[model samples]
Target: MTDGTTQPKPPRPPRRKRVVLADSRAPVTVLRTVLELEEQTSWAEEVVRGFIRTQFWTAVKLALLVIGTLGALPLVFFLAPGLSGVTVVGVPLPWILLGIVPFPLLFGLAYWYNVLAERHERDFVDMVEK
Candidate 1:
């Protein structure tokens, strides 16, 4: 057995590598699944309709609240004409309420609505996922 040629060695296989991600536990979305749901069930449509209704009612309610609060101010001034002449720090009360106060109040309402709408969307997503 000494003088002959040797057999060739087998080739080595490639090494497997692991991948790291920034967020491992995030929920995954599939377009195919969503499309299937849309085509196959009314549930998605109902959920969207419900979401729209919730948003619409929320907007309506906030609108009414703003209108009522600001509208009543004018009515109060008209009913009590002496109030218009009253001043605080040399600024008319009506001007303070109508001009200065409303901007902040409206901004607050808009912020609240944004938060509410986001919460609604989150809830809808949760429901859909379930």
Candidate 2:
């Protein structure tokens, strides 16, 4: 079992160095517009006020439309009294107009308002982010 010649060990592979992608000590800067908004500067305040004014005017217009349309129904019925007695599927015309019509009208108005409000908000955000 004893061998006179001794065998040498295989050579080892070379080690590789690690590489760094980013430096943590680098300086970071904030945008001027963002800083102004956060600090409530005069410029930022004016911009925000303008956005609110636009939204307020939009709401007022929608409110007027709703009021005018619904308010005119009663006046129309009063002017043409014969129309009030008319029936649809045995239900009074006035009842159907007053009860059923307003729901769809209001729903449509609400959806329109939502779309307008979201558009305004999106515009505001884009302005601010820029």
Candidate 3:
């Protein structure tokens, strides 16, 4: 069966690599081919490195978000009282403002936000990477 387009198909035969000597008459063509292959390899390596950089930035952004969340936890509590009635290191529940609750709270919020932020960043990175 043939489609609307009329085109002649070429026949395929041998599928093997023939070793060419250095002093072959078509040696120049072989050298050109080698250079083209090298260029393609270099381009591929650059693309790989670009992808790596994108991943690296994604990690750094996540780390900063985690640190910021942990650091700001105290501020969140300070701005709004009646959140927790637990004393933390010589400080009143949250009114004294002496210390920012325990590390667990900070760590928890940081941990949670870090994960959330990473998911968001990853979504964005995925959209851009492609």
The TM-scores of all predictions, comma-separated, are 0.70, 0.75, 0.33
Better by TM-score, candidate 3 or 2 = 2
Q: Candidate 1's residue-wise lDDT over 11-123, tens digit each?
A: 88988888764344544554433664668557667767888899999999999999998899999999999999999999999999889999999999999999999998898
Report every candidate's CA lDDT.
Answer: 0.83, 0.89, 0.61
Which regions of candidate 2 are displaced past 4 Å? 1-30
Which candidate number would show the highest lDDT if scored against the true structure? 2
lDDT of 3 by residue, 17-61 (tens): 978655456457555555544576775456546756766776677
lDDT of 2 by residue, 61-118 (tens): 9999999999999999999999999999999999999999999999999999999999
Which has the higher lDDT value, candidate number 2 or candidate number 3? 2
Best-fitting candidate, scored by TM-score: 2
- Candidate 2 local accuracy as lDDT? 0.89
| TM-score result, candidate 1 | 0.70
